[model samples]
Target: MDGLSGQGPAAADRADTAIRAIGLIKDFGDTRAVDGVSLAVPRGTIYGLLGPNGAGKTTTLRMLLGIIDPSSGSRVVLGHDRPIDAAPQIGYLPEERGLYPAMHCREAIAFMGALRGLSLPEGRRRADALLAEHGLGEWARKPIRTLSKGMAQTVQLLGTIVHQPRLIVLDEPFSGLDAINQARLEEMIRTKAREGATVIFSTHVIAHAERLCERIAIIAKGKVAFEGAVDDARAKLRPIVRLRTRNADGPWRSAIPAGTRTSGRDWEFELPESGPEPLLRALIDGGAGIETLAIERPGLHDAFVAIAGDAAAAAMKQEVPQ
Candidate 1:
């Protein structure tokens, strides 16, 4: 892909969000799960909270949702200083699955809706509608125990949004979902955002962020390693381009250009800061069949590796002090 200029939105168009957390810290006994983390989520966009399992993603969400209080620091969700007071405007789907096993799907979902202040009739109506929308209409009366894991997860997801909260926090919303269901969930999220709700979710899956999130906050070792637009995050990475050709082993191997290197058919390379047009022309002149040429901005996974690797190396160096 030819270098496309800043793709998404103008700087001014970037929505000004109200999620602010200053030195937010949460601990579990001797373990510090969230260590002085701060973040700002823009309004009217999909934000992703990403990290490996046991990396405090769940703990952080709990703190934000008022299910657990922070050990220290402060947080303001949708301008509400008190997290509990912010509950009415926030919808949270927890990491752990929980629905009354004995209750019918619609009833269980409606009950969750009630917790968000929806009345019985209103909750039931929405529950019935979402059950059908999510393809669980036929199973609406089935007990939670009788539903498949995917089905129950769908019900739980419906419960999260049934009351139409202004901000939706989904914890591993794609977990246990097959590709088809995952696609459906992704579509659901996009639709929700198009309808003007700010959706933030936590995931270990990086591609989800690449595809859907407008902004991402990546946490490693209980701290944020990076937070910004996907393109901006990628831009911070050293420039590398990937190219594919008709011949895997070609003469180009011996004639590698400066700021470039070859690895079989693949290359981890860059061009002169001046421009890439010359190099682009050189490949064509060399009879090298260029099937695909992509100017790569390192992805979230690459950034994760670079950031976490550096941190680990620094920690190891500290441990070995002279």
Candidate 2:
């Protein structure tokens, strides 16, 4: 049942959405940071919130956590109507991670759990389990200041989830970790999703979105530029299959033979909606001496660049009004 509760037959529909925001708006004096943004995060999925810095990602997350009041609009986390009401059921790891560096790893993790409404002994028990799970048991007694960035990150992660919250909001959780730790973090995120906890994280790393999230929202210039299944977002950009040959000098470069265009390295482009067979046949008949062939499907990064770029261009045009 995903450990989430709601009421009535509508409960089923509501349970699917662990977090929902409608007409969410936050203003800082004259500047509108979040402008009428509506979002839904399905239960037990790792949803990625991606955007460039100052695109209102932080502001929006703060609103979700009830850290700051919205100028307008409303949000619901789990079944809670307000952020403070949801605090005990929600775990958050902020972008700017800070801890009592002087405190030992175990104590630090336990302390955070206590703040989340866990008892002292219960917090210590959860901390031990988490540290052991993260392969940091050996350093559990060491002061946080003595641990490396990766080690400390593992502790921070443990602290955030120790109370077994139903929803977690992590901001740049992988920012300082190395490749090994990043992989570990990814694994942990997956395990959380499997345990029926809805996980929403904000990250600049597109690879994380590609690897972990079932769906992603790319927020740009204070708005959601793209949101949906990863494959769907990629499909939005269309598909292009590229053919490369040792010989760049070929007739294929000129006259693309309809529905196709030459890119580089004897490459050809085609939209998936049209299928690939026609494009493949054209390249074969071109007699371009194909040494290698590859299909270039749109990726998350491509979609992000496309949407973010368009938003920036639009903003610029508005600024240049006569």
Number of the top-ranking candidate, with lDDT as the measure: 2
lDDT of 2 by residue, 146-195 (tens): 98888888888889999999999999888878888999999999999999
Clashing pairs in 2: none
Candidate 1 per-residue C-alpha lDDT over 1-322 given as tens digits, one digit per residue, 9 for 90 to 100: 2223454442323235647677889988999989988888887789998777666778888887778899998877786778788798888898788998999988988999999999989999999999888667887789999988888888888899999988999998887787777898899999999988999999877778779999988887889878888877776676666787777655555444566666667676764464567667767777678888877667766766676565543443343313
- The 0-to-1 C-alpha lDDT of every candidate, in the order given, reads 0.79, 0.80
Query: Over 4 Å off in model 1, which ranges?
Result: 1-15, 243-268, 281-294, 310-322
Candidate 1 displacement at residue 243 in angstroms: 4.6
lDDT of 2 at 33: 90
Q: How close to the true structure is residue 254 of candidate 1, measured as C-alpha lDDT?
A: 46
Runs with alpha carbons beyond 4 Å of true place in candidate 2: 1-10, 245-265, 285-290, 310-322
Residue 317 local lDDT, model 2: 36
RMSD of each: 8.2, 5.5
